[model samples]
Target: MGKMKNGLTGGFSGKVGTLVGSSVKGQNILRNAPKKSSKNPTAGQLSHRQKFTLVSSFLRPLNGLIKRHFGSAQKLKSKVNLALAYHLKEAVNQVEDGFVVNLSKVVISKGILQTIFVDTVAIVNKELTLTWSANLVFGSVNKTDVLTVVIYQKATESMFILEQVAERGAGECKVQLPASFEDTGYGIWIFLTDVGLVECSTSVFLGEF
Candidate 1:
């Protein structure tokens, strides 16, 4: 059953046959209802579904980062959705069993802010150091910009986020790993934000270390 907003001359809301009429963002819209099928999914469809599972699960924990710094605002899609679309297309690759996110291709934050060329990723005495050189971009790079990092622990499936760990001009930032953190393999990312924290630079993957 459907209800017409302005009699039969105007748009409607509800279901009618195979079409669904609804209002979205103050606009009337009509779309076809999804049809149920008896056929089994194809191999390619299954493969894509597995990839989606892999990427979405990995990005779930970074909701705070993505929501705040992933990208500029858009009308219909949120920042997280934009990040998901980007990773699905650019960061996922097929693996032996199913799929896995290619960490090197991942981008946690995105903007016009200038980034840096990583010269080193080293950990000694439980202290992590990230060194970089200035990289050019559309916006003027500032030495006062703050560095942000996220370390993904594969064994525990957890993340350790460091906000404003150091300044970009410092060339390197040292982080003391958690006391209980064992030195297995871990994924790391680096990005920067202005002193005010109003904008961010695109993220760089430091590979698993």
Candidate 2:
């Protein structure tokens, strides 16, 4: 009975030893096993360096487009402002003359020469009259000035002398344009005196039907 008891105790001890060894081996294997990453990255997620590089790639072009649009808007605004200012100055100048020049109704009927023509539309059944004033600041002054109005077609360089008159000081001259000059666009050139002192010239268009 003593020997049987000792054998049973040894057997129990052997079983415990085997269990402890197996547990130790299992722990070591688990520690050495490959660990899984807790988080999975999507396409949007990248390294900080990569994110900065990607953003920088698109920034330059985006900035350029924004600047280009801004510049175009600024240019258009400038042109509009300039046009407004020019008309305002012209209005102020007309006030000095008591608004004698009603350019709003002026019309050029005939193509005189090279995109220039005479304002021939009859205002109040009277032939169109062109009134001009010149302030001679320098050079030789003449009391009797030879004023020549040259007309030209807007689309062509061909020009013709519409009217030439010798007048004293500032005066008004009426021109009777032939009926054939209607419908074509024209511009005017005013030559003051024979010395080629070019005065202010402007465009004239035929009135609408």
Candidate 3:
């Protein structure tokens, strides 16, 4: 065997000196070519990417809400976009045309709404109360800001058993549920929005209540 200046030498069938070369399907190929990493992405990173993409896509239609809820100024709107992109939790996912955010499992400690957590949900006499950790609203939340509540019936495959939008403050709000869905198993989701009622939280789930 004679080694060339580049170190590749001709040899027997499918053998090129130390390297292996072959013709497959009438195409010449190298067997031991430096391969690329197949599993380059960690599970955590992949999951986060998926959540971010889903949230971004869902929020596209609610740009007005983002502007109104966060602020009207262009600088404030930029902050809103960054906050939403960075503060999202892994519990976000798309369901048909809507989304489900499991609030109990979500944690948003980044961007403007730092330490924002949904702590508890209480249902009494068909009225629902949701309590959360004090939000650090960075001049984005206004008096017109509201919370949007949605109840989904998993058994009936209905995306919304009941939907309500109500005025809210920074901490919590209580709303009455329709009597019809009281006995049915339903999932609760809530998102915060401005007066425009378009911008919103990721629609965090409050479990069956």
Number of the predicted model whose TM-score against the real structure is largest: 1
lDDT of 2 at 162: 50
What are the per-residue Cα lDDT tens digits for candidate 2 across 88-149? 33422224423221223322121122222233433223234665444544355454545555
What TM-score quantifies how close candidate 2 is to the native fold? 0.29
User: Which should have the higher lDDT, number 1 or number 2?
Assistant: 1
Model 2, stretches more than 4 Å misplaced? 1-128, 134-139, 155-158, 166-168, 195-209
* Ranking of all candidate structures by their TM-score, best first: 1, 3, 2
Please give the distance, in angstroms, between residue 205's alpha carbon in candidate 3 and its true position after superposition. Answer: 2.5
TM-score for all predictions? 0.77, 0.29, 0.40
Better of 2 and 3 by lDDT: 3
Runs off by more than 4 Å, candidate 3: 1-116, 137-139, 158-164, 168-170
What shift in Å separates residue 15 of candidate 2 from its native position after superposition? 99
lDDT of 3 by residue, 1-209 (tens): 32233244532235445566654434445565454588789977776677777666544544443444443334323645654654474556557754555435432211222123578877778787777755555565554455666555545534432333445455767777666545466666566654554554454556675
